[model samples]
Target: MVQENNNKGNQISRRSFLTTGATAAAGFMIVPRHVLGGKGYTAPSDRLRVAGIGVGGKGESDIAEFAKGPADIVVLCDVHDSRAANSVKRFPKAKYYKDYREMLDKEHKNIDAVSVSTPDHNHAVQAMAAMQLGKHVYVQKPLTHDIYEARKLTEAAKKYKVVTQMGNQGASGDGVRQLMEWYNAGLIGDVHTVYCWTNRPVWPQGIPWPTEKAEVPKDLDWNLWLGTAPQKDYVNKLVPFNWRGWWDYGTGALGDMGCHIVEPPFRVLGLGYPTSAEASVGSVYVDEFKQGYFPDSCPPSSHVIMNFQGKSGDIKLHWMDGGIQPARPEELGPNERMGDGGNGAIFIGTKGKMMCGTYGMYPSLLPSSRNKEVNVAKTIARVPEGHYVQWVNACIAGYGKKELSAPFEIAGPLTETILMGNLAIRSYDVRKPKASGNGFDYPGRYIKLLWDGPNMKITNFEDANQFVKRNYRDGFTLGA
Candidate 1:
């Protein structure tokens, strides 16, 4: 059975924390070297004790990365035994559980931090619960499944006074830092437009929900796996992946790759919640005569345009997915690859344009020749430990002791900005009965949505607002 952690001794009291340094010092738990055994011995207090939820696939890799640093992987939790098997075998001494709540209830006293790498829908709740217990959190990219959840996690990071980091590893990459330095140097000359594209939905999309149900795998705790999402019977081939196309469990292509592809621009431009959002989606024809209307699944392809108020003036950002891409910049050579061929982003400024591949890799000038001619002095310090190790060290350093690359303060707005596109895409499919009652009218189509960032509302489009926050299943809640 699941249990709430209320033990005072296990919880860190709420307090205001302001981190200033980049160094990851062990969080106020320093011990004399002689106290342990010898000069070369490291004290247990210096290591961060971490518990991992969703210990499979990316989660397994995330935990392993943390283990590579001064962190001890002590507890492992996942809804499926088969998925957790590899991690369990690797971290043989670590305790294992299928439910995260039970693990936290019993092991909170031993854990100093938590790593959350579950599906997008479960990210917020798991991270929130860990934070409320005073354990620092390192959550996977896109932060949360919904805009409201992202906003709340941002606020909670401050209210709970816990160190937090998002798993958009590119935020910690040298490439993004290079882009920042160039932008700060005025090389790009005020980026007014940006285009990010991806060839995603490598899995199925724009398809109907499976009508047939399959027997639940014995190794899987189906109910727990469905945490926070509406209850539904088991479906084949949706376990490890393919959930990205569904609104109920995943955030589609934008959510899957947006954090990695759009992050460089967000960092370089200091972008926040968009002022307005609009989108156009490509449709899939079910048969020779009918267009497919799978409202529950993402479109085959989509192009979303969002308007943001930048430092100088208005900025327009475009997001493309499902193999769609923007026109090639004129400065590039005919044989030159754009954005690593499959995924990339281009920033267009007053003077020039720059582009980068996914995860902000391989940032370069439009002509590619300028990269050799012009050199900007590096201003931002790189994280030598990389994204995962950096988080582990920061957790040991405690809240307010060290700064993080993608803390919720920055990640929240970035996530909300990226998800704004999804909101517009979902809103586009809103169907309503016509006054004559003969057929449906697509009122949400071909319209720009006005967004109130502070209030998290679409002022002009009432129907679009529904996508901002979704209802959770009865057993789950994003607790304060």
Candidate 2:
């Protein structure tokens, strides 16, 4: 039987953790490392060739970090040339493309890996196509635009047997590893609930649809940006970075940051599919448009509660965006801060708690209990340092895969946790409400979403489930 972890430590002690790193510094045990399956798998003598799709914003960072590592970036692909210019500058040796498909067909063999940092909607398509070409993939999170997409990507990675990683960089952080170790050592017992929040909703909130059509920018190929998304006229509000708040291109605040913020310990603790999901949100066109711009793509803000009936008990994940936070856990240090602009997660265990700021595994909090100290497992060690180096070393020397800090298999579900939030948020725009009064299910809501991991289909709520799955513009496979 699964036992839940309570925050009541039997004993207390004062100890300052001193470690070289989590993977392997001084004392921690390092898991066995192996190159990708296949006998003749020789390390790359030529810089592992790369191509980057959706080459702007976070994509730039993804490219820069890899190029900065022991790799040679050979191709840059983005729908908008102007947005991709800086990335092109970083990889002067690489060719550029507005259409990623053409880039793949032409440079397929020449490329060993591809970084997919496109909007949520394009991630599954780009990453899956790259993997089918026998290329390694690094796609940004929420791994896919929706839940079924996440499952599809997972299956593709497994079948293709390519080394894959998600772009939730927190998966590579020092504190993230440490948090995992604490869980592995049974510090938090069997954790049943997690509360994660982010301060988003700045770009796309309660604002209404654009009053005028936005002319396509000179350098951008608008058709490509709408990849697989239903056709729509280009609007400035939908371009560059503001796409997160839209339905066709993004998954609102939850989809925007869930991959980074909610994923830290969820990955560490192994939070599989959530059983039941319900929401209470304030959207972009909500309340007749009060807060911000109401882009058709996203909601204003939401406070969603999901209950997953795990083997142990019910694990409730509380998610909020738009300047909201659960009351700070009793375990936080006095120095820790909360409020607007802070983007991170707080893992409230049965006894003590762990908290993180914008950086995922960074700025983590420990208790400052004078009366009683929170006890952690003596064998639990700190996380390995340099999340960036971890992935680099793993890719180059083939050292980190067996225990990839944030392998796509794990992070996908965590990102899906956020996708559920998208469902909750977007439900506000449901032509027919899910509930009749006060956001409760309609007098007799017929939809019962039963998510089976490997299958990824809702046994009940057939129509509602399909709505959650969404229809892609032709040519987009839901992965497997």
Candidate 3:
């Protein structure tokens, strides 16, 4: 998706600033200096009041970072009280709740923005709720669990007229802009092929669900944690982390790091949606003889090829996970590391190649020495305040008054591109009974699935379409 430049010629008036400020500081006031006799009077108009959902771990850090700017942590929500302890301790004055639904319903008027750093499954619901309340939202990466959710949230951002930003901090980094400038400067000419690899799924995957159920933590509301996912008993090590391996909760290694890894090429090339997708996955053997069948779990490893119709020509992007790295370019020295050791990306243009580490960090020309020789003019502005604070400033500046690095307008398509890889990975295991009623036939395997991007479908494969939009459990909706 091409983002419209909403910042052009738009200015924030003092009246609009105060109006937005009052909404953020609703039910509370920043004492004016006139009342206290000239100590200081920072206008509440200068601040943004933010409520955080899933305020633990990454969420904890997200809230803390937002607090570093002109923003206040007014409310916090998380399913597990134990996980939320540090944030609760740090923002003691902030009200705490276990259910995000209740927290937003009660506190929406008091906060101008919502920060969501929850699991992949809950991201859409939580973010959509906040946006529906006319509040700006900052969501963690991958944006949503399914393609449909990403599309809905993207549209809702514009519909609600809210400021939206995804939590892929790399989109705001200097490295990506540098890569963009180099590409724009023709240092790398017309990238037709791209490779993005990651050493991830550091969590368990490609295994059957544990038959045994663990007791729910005393502090955790298991039902709330499940959210839109199917009803199920709690499993050990599924909370605080490790949910990434499950199909119901996480988007696997591709989703875990794709936004950060694939973003550089996507932005530098101005990519839209992929026209086709095909993937091959690494399998796990149950014993010594038979391969395991765990459709609910993500594969141990995968390599997906996505074909996008770029502006200049067709661009083929390759996504590899679980320690799979592409062949080193001829220009790169054998001793030189590829993409920060374990994770990185490489772009192959007609004239040359360039690579970067994860989060678009440490970008360099293929020869590595060429980086020192090239002096491209910096065309893109850098986010010195970093990603989290950028959102806070944008929220304070009001909607469309300032530009964001990963606004939903841009992030939605990037997320769809990432999830498209997952769709292929999931479809890789799709099976059907053979005519003889024999073992099985995996039709989705080794076949290029044609994509109808705007319609969100795999035209050639009917079974693969099942994953395009998931059915949420009862009592949950996208709420768009």
Top lDDT hit:
3
lDDT of 1 by residue, 372-465 (tens): 9997887789999999888776666566767799999999999999888999888743366555332434455579999999999999889888
Error of 2 at 396 (Å): 4.2
Least lDDT summed over 10 consecutive residues: which range in candidate 1? 9-18
- Runs off by more than 4 Å, candidate 2: 1-46, 184-188, 283-295, 331-335, 339-341, 362-366, 370-385, 396-402, 428-454, 458-460, 475-480
Better by TM-score, candidate 3 or 2: 3
* 165-275 per-residue lDDT for model 3 (tens digits): 999999999999999999999888899999999999799988889999998889999899999999999999888788999999999999999999999999989999999
Model 2: residue 5 alpha-carbon error in angstroms:
43
Clash totals for all candidate models: 1, 20, 0
Error of 2 at 350 (Å): 3.2
In angstroms, the error of model 3 at 308 is: 0.7
**Model 1 scores what on Cα lDDT?**
0.85
List the global CA lDDT of all models: 0.85, 0.65, 0.87
Model 2: how far residue 429 lies from native, Å: 9.2
Angstrom error at residue 123, model 3 = 0.5
